[model samples]
Target: MENNQEGILLTSAEQSYLWTTYQADTMAVCVFNHFLQHIKDNEIKSLIVFALQLSEEHANFIREIFIKEKIQIPQGFTESDVNLHAERLFSDVFYLNYIKNMAKGGLVTYGRVLQNVYRKDILSFFSACLSQSIELNSRAIDISLKKGLAIRPPTIPYLEKLEFVHKQSFILEGLGRREALTGTEVTNLFANIQTNYIGTSLATAFSQVCKTKKAQNFFKRGKEIALKHIEVFSSYLKMSSLPVPGTYEQMVTQSKDAPYSDKLMMFHFSLMIYSGVGNYGLSTAETQRSDLVADYTRLNAEILKYSEDGANIMIAEKWLEQPPLAANRRDLAKG
Candidate 1:
């Protein structure tokens, strides 16, 4: 942690918050601008505009703090990374779904940062961010539901009696048929499926537009992984006689022209892969069924390896930024 005699220095937590927000907001600006150029739905377009404004405001506020602290601001994604005149990469519905997922991520991120932040100003800033994220999440949900675009988890029949676990089979797969999934299990499964759907679409688009063969190969591999995960999850739903959530892969255009720089696209997919792994871990914990837990565990391992490869690519390209770290006592001693 950096500190001064006057106690005006930024703590590690505050530094982390500022850095992450700057990067996220910068990426959001590029993504939102591209969406704005292609979006046709007035309702979805309005929400995107609102979200973009918030992201821009956040970027500006974080930059001001970085300037005050004399910290070098990260040159994240920018107009140079995006082409507003490029052909559409995703449909309008994909834009709405992307924002909805982003809002959920924002709420979770702000809430976690608020817990770690100790500086009064930083705490207050994250508190407000959490509030705004909540509002955006609610609005996105309302719009999605109203327009019949929300991919809700299947609802089961109401239980008539309180039942207790009678056998170990309740948590394990038995020799025979397994019981139907609980509501929490269903929710987790569907959420994972939904994320993979979005990933598949994005990876497909990137595969077609990335400049380098290496980047294109990575995107193509990611698309295959997402499709396999979706199939695995869809099978679970089908076994339960639940309707599998549909994807918007068909909405991607055939244009091979890159709308985003290769670096930006790689970073964006890396973020999605990391987020997916986190979600899978949480989903694994929420499941009591042995088979489903095993599935999540195995899939998480696959993506974890993939994410490591992505990091290596970023490092090779000098695109990966170093986050805040504690002082190196060994170096100080050597000096």
Candidate 2:
């Protein structure tokens, strides 16, 4: 246990938060640099500039803490991980959506991390992160709306009257017997579909630009999985005669230049996979429908498998960075 002047040690939760946050911020810095290289839209460029500044600040803050604590700072994504000369791979609209989507993840992450952190400075850092993420999301959404690019979640009919379900069948789904989707289920389905839409396009672009055969195959498989999940999610909406979110594959350009290194792209995919799993877990926990729960569970398993394979690839390439670990008493005994 490390003791500072305050006599408090950094707990597992705090360390984990800081370690993972450092990685994510560094990756963001790399991608933002690439975006800045080719972004022509002044407004979108402004958002990128703000996002890059935040990520750089976060990485530097973590670096100082690690230095003071005598911990090894993570070699997160760097200049070598991005190619500024590569052609633009995505549209201006995607840059906005990417920022908005990533900001949502930041809000979720910072909020969760904030709850588990208690040190005054750590607490303040995460609180600021939450505020910044919210502002980022707000800014991106405002710009998206201005450009008519915001794909707002679908709205269901207003409740005419409150009602209660008296039968267990309300939780069950089957041929000719499934009840209409509830508001929560509708929201989850719509949000997941849109996320898959983004994933589908990302996978496609990665497939086109990934450097190696193994990575290309992995990304192609990811695109297939994302498309299948989108179909599965959209089916539930169709069953109830509701609208589904549209795909964004056209948002990707025809450029095959590898804007990001294979290591960076693989890490980015892992982050997306983890986020998707968390989303599915939340959706499963919140939904009352048995069928939806089963599908979320099954699909999450497939994604986990894909994520594991991605991990193996990263490990093989020496691109996977280990996190801070607790002391091993057995190893200490050997020493």
Estimate every model's Cα lDDT from 0 to 1: 0.86, 0.88
The best candidate in terms of lDDT: 2
What are the per-model numbers of colliding residue pairs? 0, 0
Candidate that would win on TM-score: 2
Model 1 Cα lDDT, one tens digit per residue, 43-62:
99999999999999888888
lDDT of 2 by residue, 59-152 (tens): 9887887777777889998899999999999988788888988998998888788879987777878888899999999999889899898888
In terms of lDDT, model 1 sits at 0.86
- How does model 1 score by TM-score? 0.94
lDDT of 2: 0.88
Pairs in clash, predicted candidate 2: none
